[model samples]
Target: MTLVFSTCCFSPFPPLHPGRLTVLPQEALVQIGGSIQLNCSLDCPDGTPQWKGLDTNLGNIISTPTYSLLLITNATVAMEGTKFCVGNCQGKSHQGSTNLQVYSLPDTLQLETQPKELVAGQPAHLHCSISKVYPPGSLTLSWYRGDQRLESPDAEEVADDEELFSYDSELEVPGEKVTEGMEFRCEVELLLPPSDRSFHRATAVTVSTKGKSWRSELGILARWVCNFSCQSHFPMSLAILVCQG
Candidate 1:
């Protein structure tokens, strides 16, 4: 009697995987006219994988059973946003996303001056104009004297083209604080994605004080100190006195 094989008694269920999805380079900061590449992977991949939130026509994309790659060419400010990819893992759909930020910086930073001569004790005006910057909202302008931060001024309101914008800031230096040969610096900070970057321009003014040069003043003070020290320690060596002077 050929025993018919007992009907197989086994339950089939889909694999138990979290279906974790990952996107490499989750955040990117790219200059305008640059390119970016992103990778998406899924755990226990199953079916076809695809990309979303970006125009496929603008990028080169490769898909596989477990991962997908996307390379965007000639990136522009309009393409700055979150991009997503979807993958199938264990019969379930998994998705991952990355953030893209595009920015531009001026080739040169120039602080425009109103007067040819910056005289001490005179109210002076300076203007910093930054052009062709993306996401202008992330830009800030600050003023500094030597290593001391003076102030951070609000950007002047301007028409936004949505692609590129210009920032203009005007700073007024009070005459009372102005000193001859004092340096004033204008710094621009880009609070873009990934990190913050800074650039600066500096200027100085001339003081018309009717007094001996600072060098001469220092020399006189040095001589007074040397005389006092020599008198306190009488018969001090001339070489030591000269060294102190």
Candidate 2:
């Protein structure tokens, strides 16, 4: 009996498996002085994952068997960029990336009225200013009156620099439209990528008609009180008393 010689070829290392790679927060909006964490995960247990496009010295990184974490503290404009995660599974390379948008938003909005005295039938101006905002190009200014949008002015050009900047916007209102106890609002919007954030400041002005006497002003005040009383559903007698007084 003749036995045919058979030979089998085998390798000591197990076959490599291809697995899915995922990165969380594909797009992030990190406010100035805030922090963010990004995660990179791999399904293939044999894969080695690493971070790219990140300064290891600036941020902290945590590595585990199946995932990696990147922590950014005190995010600022310098940290705005794309970050990548590269993984090798079964000798094949895979990459996942996330976009970081670091922005500075004004903590407060200031609204000021030109000319201490607001008079009816004359043009008046409202100035809105927001300070310490980064990426001023993405900023927008809007004027509103009681939920009514009066106008949206284009953002003025500002010098691009590492330091934060300030912006000013002005609105001119016809005196005829300015009434006693009129509320004007200035809204600031940061049109950042992924989503937009906004803040607003409002001021109420007491306007007097041109050439109006003190008695007329007092009457206007009384009428305002009466209107408030009526709107509050106070007793009709109280409303009448407010106007009479």
Candidate 3:
């Protein structure tokens, strides 16, 4: 690899030795809320390296006679950028930089099913929603039923707020496949493990085929309620009840 060096000079530092200055890990990729340290060392002690950035929030800096260090504790997405350590090298300014990138996962995953109850031979709509995701356009959402992959809607992304995103994956089920006791789920995939905010990535909702028929069950429930309504304090007409599948 071809190695190129830069010369940077400032009035505050004395003339530096004509030698090499190396900054470990020229680039850094860290998770949000994580910490990282960038080290800059000079071959000769004639000059001291200092860390600086256009933004003060880039992090804290520590300097010693031996080396200069940039410490970013509790790093946030806003702090991702290039930081520099420059010193006067042989009457010229020599510089090194650290490129930092921050990443995070969605805060919560949710699954929604249309007409909460699923019946055999009934068409149903299921949707998976991901909220508070960072670094948009890096998400892939897929749908699954048990061990089988289901035909899912194209995952869509939306800007929820500045620097935050929301995603949705929709799946439409044909009535023939609609059956009770089948679990459907959605997952948000990440490129690496220890992903930021990644947890219980999937949401599963079971399909139900309870009750012989929706029409009959509603009639039966209504009749059963009215049978004792006159005797009961609450009138059946004024009472509302939800049937369990």
Alpha-carbon lDDT, every model: 0.71, 0.75, 0.71
C-alpha positional error of residue 154 in candidate 2 after TM-score superposition, expressed in Å: 3.0
TM-scores of the models, in the given order?
A: 0.66, 0.70, 0.64
lDDT (tens digit, per residue) of candidate 3 on 29-101: 7767889888987666667767755556666778875478888888776887777777765566678886776
* Model 1 C-alpha lDDT versus the unseen true structure: 0.71
Candidate 1, residues 1-245, lDDT tens digits: the string is 78775647754765577778888886676778888888888876464667876675768998887788888878787777888888776567778787887877776666776554566678788787777776767777777766778875687746456568777877787888667776777777777645564444334334445333655786777677677776686445753565466
User: Could you give the C-alpha RMSD of every candidate to the true structure, in order shown?
Assistant: 9.9, 9.8, 12.3
In model 2, the Cα lDDT at residue 162 comes to 62
The 10-residue segment with the lowest total lDDT in model 3? 191-200
lDDT, residue 69, candidate 2 = 89
RMSD of 3: 12.3
Best by TM-score: 2
Candidate with top lDDT is 2
- Model 2: lDDT to the true structure: 0.75
